[model samples]
Target: MLRAIAVAVLAIGIILVALVEAPIPAVALTAVTGVTILLLLWPRSSRDSVAPSAPEPPMADARAPIEAISDPLLIVAGSRVEQANAAARKLFGAHVVGEDVRVAIRHPAATDRLAARQATADQEPIELAGIGGRDNRWQMHVADLAGDRALVHLVDRSEGHAAERMRVDFVANASHELRTPLAAILGYVETLDDDAAAEAGTRKRFLRIIRDEAWRMQRLVEDLMSLSRIEAEKFRAPETAVDLAGLAKEVHATIRDAADPRSCDVAIAIDEGLPLVAGDRAQLSQLLHNLVGNAMKYGRPGTPVTIRASRGPGAMVRLSVEDQGDGIAPEHLPRLTERFYRVAPSRSRSLGGTGLGLAIVKHIVERHRGRLDIRSTPGEGTIVNALLPIAPLSSNRNATVTGPA
Candidate 1:
């Protein structure tokens, strides 16, 4: 308001001076009037037209925060690389910043989907080959930002996918294993029932066959249940201190009593003063039993099977079952702990093996935070070693040694 009044007064003074024809005042007023007119009427300069303009909107920094994330992420702007997170840099190298989205990712499917003009705002999984010959999968989401820009987000799914595949395979394999024994039991029982009216000798043979099949089926069911329990309780270790030497002796006696005449001679060599292992006594006994039994079953007749135990590093006790049987091939050794996996399916079946023994042993050992090692050479011998962590034997719980056999 003050400025407007001053301007009005100046204009009036200029008009009066112009009318009175005072040369000095008239010239001063005229000069001031011309300056004011020029200030008001000069073409308006555009504020946005200035050089070195202001910074972009906050949306431009939308990707700045995500750059700190550890997981790979990409900011795609119309099929072009707008920005990439730190993880993406580490994954694809720093040269990917301005590179084409397709060329940078190097995955045809991912790139093609990203480049599709009609692509919907949906999330899809894309698998790609990563460094070091590893396979990587990403859950990709395409979202539209302001203007023609779009944001592509990547979430790793490789581990999740692998776990899902393993679960499916485990279910399939377990079902097949259970079905085989069930089919045998059912078939044999039906036959025995049909032949019940036959001669005494025939009836006796049928009954024996039925009994064997039933026992085999029972063993299979028992092993399956044992495996399930082991897996369920695998996260917690047993709170018992089991004597290594005593357990070995018991297992040795049991195996010897039950051994076939033609089977290998079972021997025990437990180191004196061997530390007790922390484990469930019954589970540990079962573990030892399975190992010794496996060795005897697969070992060559007239050979020797040695059960040895000694103090291992880190307060651990190592128990090993060594057999002079035809050793498993290298290809089959890795999978020996898998449920129902057999090196020689036919021969193993003939030997009355349920194939869940080693699998159960593995779960038990792992529950105690122990390691199981299988070392073998074809035609030589196979050794199964279980390294169990030992707890201090003071007021700690004592592991009961369930009788072997």
Candidate 2:
């Protein structure tokens, strides 16, 4: 603007001078004055003569470390979402950049916190439920990067909350199971000692009650330990070849000899030449035992408990243990693998169950990268299907190849 005005004033002065003086002298005078003015107005290249460049942002360096984290990350400058990492882009979309932090996040609590004067250390993390979709849970953690700047991290807490709930329920159920047996054992033992004149028949019955209660406690403890071991090993896949059909035969025979007369007949109809499954032998055996035993225990009196193995697509083997008995309710089927859950708690206990059978089986199947399915009809029977991946051909060479039933 200044340069344009200077040029205009020089032109006007030249015109006024030309009107009052000779054309030759007026042109010469205009040229000298314009040249002098141009020399004075020209910009210099020295630092003192030039304008300063914009300063480097202090928080620019802070983004690299936050970007390295796998969780969603957002860098906020006052009310604006100045920067966002890849995860944040995936979660909230690319429009998050340059937008207000409150609008980008859209959660009231999170926006409120971002608008806060300071992010205190003791402030609770903001929980964002059903973000992106329902059934998803996220927790937002904010850290003060600098004045009016913050680092926001989003962590998925769905699995964490579920694990916590399972843990709490497990402890509660375990306590209840043990307390019942312990109370029974203590009460019966006290009765045996106090009744000196009790008949031999009465004394024998009392002793049997004591023994049963004690054994129930022992079995519960064993199952709890087994479940702990199985869960600890769930992340580590098994490599050993386990025979589901053979294991089923062994369990069937054992149950047959010990089964009550009124109990269902145990039948093993698995394929004899099925491919071996990649799994731990002992855990697989326990898996078969639990399924077969549950069938026998829960099946209708005098009905057949059928055990069958078949080859499936994708080099997988399926082991099915079915019972023709009072089938489980539809609602109960979903939580069948939960620890210490029972369709009929009294009946389950009376039949010598620890209630951890299905839970342990579930963990064992997971460790082997296998899938377990339970299907039942109201008036019919229940069938538990265990689908395990077949062992690699090279893994079973020169080894006792077995598969899950």
Backbone clashes for every candidate come to: 1, 9
Candidate 2, poorest ten consecutive residues by summed lDDT: 38-47
Q: Where does model 2 exceed 4 Å of error? A: 1-70, 80-139, 145-147, 199-201, 262-264, 393-405
lDDT of 2 by residue, 168-202 (tens): 98899899999998998889888988998899999
- Kindly report which residue stretches of model 1 are placed more than 4 angstroms away from their true locations once superposed: 1-67, 89-95, 106-137, 143-149, 192-197, 262-264, 393-405
Best by TM-score: 1
TM-score against native, each model = 0.73, 0.70
What lDDT is reached at residue 242 by model 1? Answer: 80
In order, the Cα lDDT scores of the candidates are 0.70, 0.75
Error of 1 at 44 (Å): 26
